[model samples]
Target: MPMEIRLVRIDDRLIHGQVATVWAKVTKVNRILVVSDDVAKDILRKTLLKQASPPGVIVNVITIDKMISIFNDPKFNDFKSMLLFTSPRDARRVVEGGVKLDTINIGGMSFSDGKKMITNAVAVNSEDIEDLKYLNEQGIKLEIRKVVADNKVYMMDLLKKEKMI
Candidate 1:
């Protein structure tokens, strides 16, 4: 069965103003499926995220396993949803677990210790590079674009140029 996953985006701040008002309009996605164990279990964060979504858009906070299950289920085949993951590992899990995607977007990861800052908001570590390499090997197109209007930079090429991997 084919899943109507319009966008597979890795954004730390999920369902915020830009995502709710801009990306949703550009992608035309009605549902936003946030796949993350940490966020799924956080009541306050989850509620805040839910409230951030636009009035007509449905936002679902689920774990990686739950997203895998949902992808396997036939009921969501027709749902036009954006799959949001907090990390590359989380995105890799769903893709490796039988979910299909031709493209993946990296919006933000935030700078942190032991992580190389690739873009203004995207910082990647060794594990993230490995996950990205795996996805590239699987023939998934990867790009770094903060918002819909921004010009997307091919992530793998950027990694090669920066010698991060």
Candidate 2:
């Protein structure tokens, strides 16, 4: 069997309380792949994320290319993973690089300069909107929910309501 990618989520916070606790349980994934070049290079953040991992779940901070490579390798087929990306562009890159993902959860994109709030937790700039639209156009389901219990909202609908698309 191929590597089972249980969930693909985009959250700028990466691994945090909600992710390490709630998401890991909900996804039933043994591995959490933090697929980001920036975080992979930051030793402090990488160590922090590893320390923040859930009891049984293994966390790996790796670049986009490394994720693509390992994901394609047959040797890693036993991994049931939940991939975390800091941006829609990164998720798009991994998808375009040949990771077969059908849905991406927009967990949290914190308020930042030059970004407009779509929801209480999600803020997106023009570039983010573009990348999100590209993923939507590629027939990927974009869901917005901070936690598994929250009602899932469609990203495109929020974009349309905000007049972003």
Candidate 3:
């Protein structure tokens, strides 16, 4: 089926309990691909993420370019992967790189310097807003939810409420 992308989630804290247990079960993904340049470069972090994954599910940490490469390769068609990104900017880059994404789940973005809180679990800076806006412009549905059981909140609605859009 050409490597089904079960879900594309943006969570600063990747591969957490909710992701490992809930999302993994809901999506029925055999592989969890963490596409982050920083995490892929950090050996300790890479190993930790792998260790954090749920049993029976393989986890791979790789750069965005590598993801695009394997995604386009025929040999990788056997995987049903759930892609994890740390930021909307990285997700946007992958989208621009020609990976078709219909939707992106904004799992969590903790409060950081110069960022405004949109939701308790989500915060955004000007750069984040721009990247998110770009993704929205590409006709991708952006939703915010900490877990599968949580009600889906449309990201643009929150942005509009915050007057960021």
Best by lDDT: 3
Winning candidate number (TM-score): 3
After superposing candidate 3, which stretches have Cα over 4 Å from the reference?
none
Ranking by lDDT: 3, 2, 1
lDDT of each: 0.89, 0.92, 0.93
Which pairs clash in the backbone of model 2? none
Give the per-residue lDDT digits (tens) of candidate 3, residues 33-93. Answer: 9999999999999999999989889999999999888887888887899999999999999
**Clash count of each predicted structure:** 0, 0, 0
- lDDT at 69 for candidate 2? 87
Q: Return the lDDT, model 1, position 119.
A: 85
Error of 1 at 160 (Å): 0.2
Which stretches of model 2 miss by more than 4 angstroms?
A: none
**Model 1 spans > 4 angstroms off:** none
* Models ranked on TM-score: 3, 2, 1
